[model samples]
Target: MSVFNQPRRRIVVLIILGLAMVLIARLSYLQIVEKKYQRLADANAVTKKIVYPSRGIIFDRKNRSILGNDILYDLVVTPAAVKNIDTSYLCEILEINKEEFIKRIGDAVKRNGRVRPSVFAGLLSAATFSRLQESMYLFQAGFELVQRPIRSYPYKAAANILGYIGEISPGMLKTDKYSDYQSGDYIGLTGLEKTYEDVLMGQRGTRYIIKDNLNRPQGALENGDFDTAAIAGKNLRLSLDIELQVLGEELMRNKIGSIVAIDPSTGGILAMVSGPVFDPNLLTGSSRTKNVSKLFVDPTEPFLNRGIQATYQPGSAMKPLTAIVALDEGLITPDFGFPCHGGYTSCKFIKCLHSEAGHAANLRAAMAHSCNSYFLHLYRMEVDDRKWGGVKKGHAKWKEYMSRFGLGHRLGIDIPGESPGIVADTTVLNKRYNGNWNSCSELYVGIGQGQVAVTPLQMANAMCLIANKGSYFLPHLVESIDLDSSDLLKKFKERHTVAKISDTAYHSVIYGMEDVIEHGTGRGAQMNGIAVCGKTGTAQNRGIVNGKAVDLKDHSVFVAFAPRDNPKIAIAVIVENAGTGATFAVPIANLMMEKYLRDTLPLSKQPIMKRMLETTTIQLSKLETSKIDSLNATTGMLTSEAILKKYFH
Candidate 1:
């Protein structure tokens, strides 16, 4: 009886020991080795906040702040944590009605689940933030304040050049280009802001904090061991001269036009003015969406970066390239003379403005007078030369020369939305004229009319080529990024050779341009002491009027470089529907040159400045209506008949 009872007792003791070991192992796994339960516990008791980095600042060539940073506050909401609070009182603090409060809560829920935070009201003023912060504790666990960096324009100028930032769209978030971005991140939408977004957008950081049972942050988790500090974006220095830019804008105000000024030495833009531009601050803060909507539908098209995006026929402003091409090809000498009988002999549609009897002229005289007949002769020589065999080959050669000059191409500017313009290559000419075009058929291109078009930027760059005597750097807005940045900005530092024209040819052409400002068509552009080499152009365009195609008055265009030799600035100015380059564009170009080269206008030119500022080329009614017919009909038709008669008659 004793032996059998001993064996059963040993077995029972063994089974109890095995069950005890299993229970100990399960408790150890849950308490120490497994992290899922601990993670779940932390999720309910910790808050992770994203820290946004400050955007980079922008400075002008003179080190003046063109764009700066300002601190703004956002009202953030966590829908799930909202409890029994005074909803009406909170809405009153936010200055929003009950309906808006409900809608924002719903939106916050839709954007991010109820547990996550979303922006309820963005870009609040300091006064409003102070009022709301005073009452913030009443809405604890449901509402909080987040600081955001917003752009501030101190000079209130260069809106088109600096651009604006806005929230990234849902479409952008889906694309590979913006893969690093999230739903509420801001991105540059245009101009330099868009081009240098990578360098300007600094690295964001994150911080973790312990929360209490009420879901309120108590303190940093683990003494801030997991917290990461935000890295501020790199600063940028621009090539623009803010004073010159301001002056250009003032002069071009109340007009529909653009002005582009470049440093021929560096190809860095000095001043770029697109008229009818709005205050850049309009696109910032609480009113941004509303203001953008207003601008989007505005008839004047203030959003268009006309300096780079708007294309015009370029008028006689294109003749300098023609002269250079002819001289470079050795088809014509500076001394080569053409007898102008008020028009091209082969093309009566092209008229000469110099004289009814016509001037027997050399290249310099033709350029000074902007003689259509003479340039027509030169254009024909370049495209119909016997050495090239035929119009097709000669035209191809001419097209090649144009391409080298940065015409009919993007020119690879750092800014976005630059137009290549119309070069009327062999393919385009074939399409337009059904392969029946010849040198004479496209002779209108010789005078900067017909299908040949250019932007103010391209025109200014062409003048840079002439000022540098056949070589140029690609035009760019940014001068330098911070030293630590790894960006593609170094690409702009390279030089480009447009042509191999002789110095002698340049001298001859320059002499003609000098005469142009001194005593010829561009005489209005003359400064008291500076010698400005300039050319005037009247580009022809057509528009529909009263449901019929009508001839619009030509666009006024002028291009120049001064003090002629060792030129400091190369510029192009275009005034739409403004008759004669001398009337509108020349004076503005002269004023801008004076302001930049001399730093101030002479007392004698004060009257001219006043007159320029007061002149209004755009009619208010037409701009307000924004109808296509109204825009087309009012443009180029606003020039006084007296001015038209003086130029055309």
Candidate 2:
């Protein structure tokens, strides 16, 4: 029994010895083989570091210039390692206020993890960085520069079109919908920036590094093996000519309206100008807070992209659609006639513009004369007359025809924030009047008055459809996106047909428009050797001219494409409160067309861009109603007696 117990004790001692050996081997492995854990044990002696890759550049499609930048700089701060940092002297060197210096360092302590460094300030330009780099010892331990990029826009005036960038909002960050974006990242706020954000923003790259006890990066401990190389954003070649765009903006200075031009075949925007355009540069860098706020509060609404955002009554521009509908409905032949014996009075209170006398006219002659009576007659015959089928058939048919031509809905342009022009539906009318829908509603819609509204872009797009013989591409600002070997132009190269009107019907409409610019209302747009085709529209408004409600003025509007056949460009011009379309809008449209077509023509011969500019300046200067000492001399009409009775009574 003693011998057995001795063996058991020996066996137990041997087992204890084996267990001790295994424990020693495990400790050796953890200390030697797993050096990472050993190093982490002495966390106070080492620091973990991350390297941010340089951002990519954004270039214009033409390769003419750089539109964005990946500017890099150092952001310095003190950490646990920098125990002897002279807070007062450091503040002096960094040019920060004493209280700010204390608060920033406190924030760094809260945000920084253990020995991790924090960025107190950033974006030191190269020159300042060079001067500071020589005095590195002054900052000591925790001082370091973390490289990062700044958002940039090279073309300053193109802010409305190019848009500005800002930090991603808290709401945007919380959603996680944009998987690519992280916290404290810049995002496109408006314009092309917002429209093509996904394409512009590339993947971010990161690198790991080891730091010394002083928090200075010792080396690329991982040598960028895990880093992603930043990819440059694809270049966007816009259809806009920089020179023409600048000239267009200068032309529309101080005015309240928009100028829209497009390539008739492709719907490539040539120039889109709105008056009082703010400089996009104002929204960049550290200065944006003050400037952007003032701009936002300004009464002029400088931020509004009037070209595709604002809608107005098309006025006589809708005449083309009206005529097309009338012809298609078989309500009238090309020679359909209506006598405007002054004006068409439907009721005591409702009267057409031609109330004085009527003119003998067919469709062609009616368009030439802008005969309101003729359109009113067509609306009554084709729409209001129950014999032809009343509201539902007429309204539905009109809507179908307009929709086919891409009205009443977003034209689906590549740009963001596009406004779908207002189309008065019978349902909307029924809801509004509780089924008291009468000839009154149909009549106003026929004449492009009342609730019918269209953006300048929609109007220009419609005109381009007409100019292209009833087919069009969606209006797109970006002509192509080329990055690496990928050419995105081919994807957008497909021709989209907006409508399919017959060749004969198209020709008939084209001839009428051609006549408008030549022997009719749009004579203001005619130029030598340029067979311009266009129409004029005047949207009437009732407002307080002085202290009384009166017919204030008409918005002048023009839609035209030049050289008639094989048209190069089409344009729509609208000048708010400018009395006549032919007088105000046509001249501007003519100028734009002339400049675009004859851009290479000798400076002396390039009268179009210049004339367009001068005319806009002259018109805007005349907006001051108080300057009109003798209103009757220019207006040739007195205030309505009803207005006087309403106020002076």
Candidate 3:
């Protein structure tokens, strides 16, 4: 009792009181001043949301439509919010059975988080959605409809050129790089869609919105300040002219091959048609999934872009290029002719054809008559000459010419599956022959028979270069890009230069090419008042003969550009198994050119030609039979009656 009454005891009591007062004041500040922080935690826990943006448009050069816009609807589900989802009732509303409903819901639950929503089904029609909307509220986890822009092809041709968009794959979804895409997201699967995916598919937009207790969107979060507007995909105005494309497609109706047209000045792809084309609408909107599956499973490949993918030996078409190389290398002059004794001589093999009458004259006549013997002589003499150095040097120089003409390499065109054709390296030849390769080993290459191969696109572009007198543009389908709100694509339509040749060389080559249409194998492609310049090719292809290989058929090819004095359009046509260039390929090219320039062309006398392109479904049937017969010797399936109509009707 005496110690408590002392001055030290009184001071300790005062310090304890001050500490207790401070603790009480801090507790009051936390409960009253920081209470708003707790509301944010509650808001985040219950909110559920997603944003979808409009897809981009695809257009023709004039912004007239190639692939534009169409309606696409999807059925989406949120598993956590899906309560009271009367299985039988909901299924009936959505036109699905109970089993399907369960499967969809189960998939969504497994694939996505419990609170997050996922697409249950895709490509729904508007009529189906109307019925679904009536009882959609009954689904415990709510279902909603999202309208998306599906790809549409207005011209309905060019399916392989425009390509298609498809759903994202599960494997792709698993990759960290694809985190931006959901299961329902569409991707460019082929053609230009795949080639220019980045430019065509714009950046996705995003928005935030507050949700109520039921997880429904209340309104724009924070008054719309937190939204990202989706940038619409750039509209691709392809260099393709719709009218020209339609004419080409119509001309190739019953044929099994490809036609490619380019502008001499711009490398713009005016027309591209692969025969037996399935409708682009078949790959768009509601029909896309079912039709694409059918197309994929069909034996005949309607999806293959034959213009750039199919490699064919240039054949007689290579004659002009060979002549050019010879002239450029100073191996031959206009009058310094070679005697085509109907063949060429080599130590390893003697190369000759069925032709006994070879042109014994200048380069001009050899090209005019398409004399193979002339090319054989020139190749042997030039390659073996030491003036331009050794055989390797000659071959390299020849390769350079090929490259200049966009051969033995992939032309930078905007298409998928484009092959670089086939060019052999010296080392490769040396290895194959055990270090004893000769000029004679590659002798056939001079005539485009050995290892030289080119695509129809390359052939057309090469012709354009010659027509333009030595310069070319990078061949392109999309001539321009258009934004949604502007008429600014004009700036993008400028020409893109690829190469330039000398004027003298260009004019000389043009003269020889002009002679081809005037009095040569390519005479069939000549049009009235068009001044067409052209070259013809008949390439031997393999076939089965008495249990052995034989060159039983030929690929007919024709390359030309119209209005020889001032070329406007250049075209290449290839008809598979068509026997001769003049018979099949040249005629088609002529018809197309006339339709483009003069608008008056006659129809083919062959009944098969008339019927091959009756309708997409029917034509595809014939193509299927042809493909099946090509692949299997044992399959005894006859051509479909629908296809037989072409021959018998």
The best candidate by lDDT is 1
Report lDDT (CA) for all predictions: 0.84, 0.68, 0.70
Lowest lDDT 10-mer window, candidate 3?
628-637
Per-residue lDDT over 18-38 for candidate 2, one digit per residue giving the tens place of the 0 to 100 score: 999999999999887766565
The TM-scores, one per candidate, come to 0.89, 0.79, 0.82
Number of backbone collisions per candidate = 1, 11, 11
lDDT of 2: 0.68
User: Which segments of model 3 are wrong by more than 4 Å?
Assistant: 1-49, 93-96, 174-179, 207-225, 341-360, 483-505, 543-552, 598-649
Better of 1 and 2 by lDDT: 1
TM-score preference between candidates 2 and 3, better one: 3
Report how far off residue 453 is in candidate 3 (Å). 1.5
**C-alpha lDDT (0 to 100) for residue 223 of candidate 1:** 77
* List of clashing residue pairs for candidate 1: 577-636
Worst 10 residues of 2 by lDDT: 626-635
Judged by lDDT against the true structure, how good is candidate 3? 0.70
The local lDDT score (0 to 100) that residue 288 gets in candidate 1 is 80
Q: Tally clashes: model 3.
A: 11
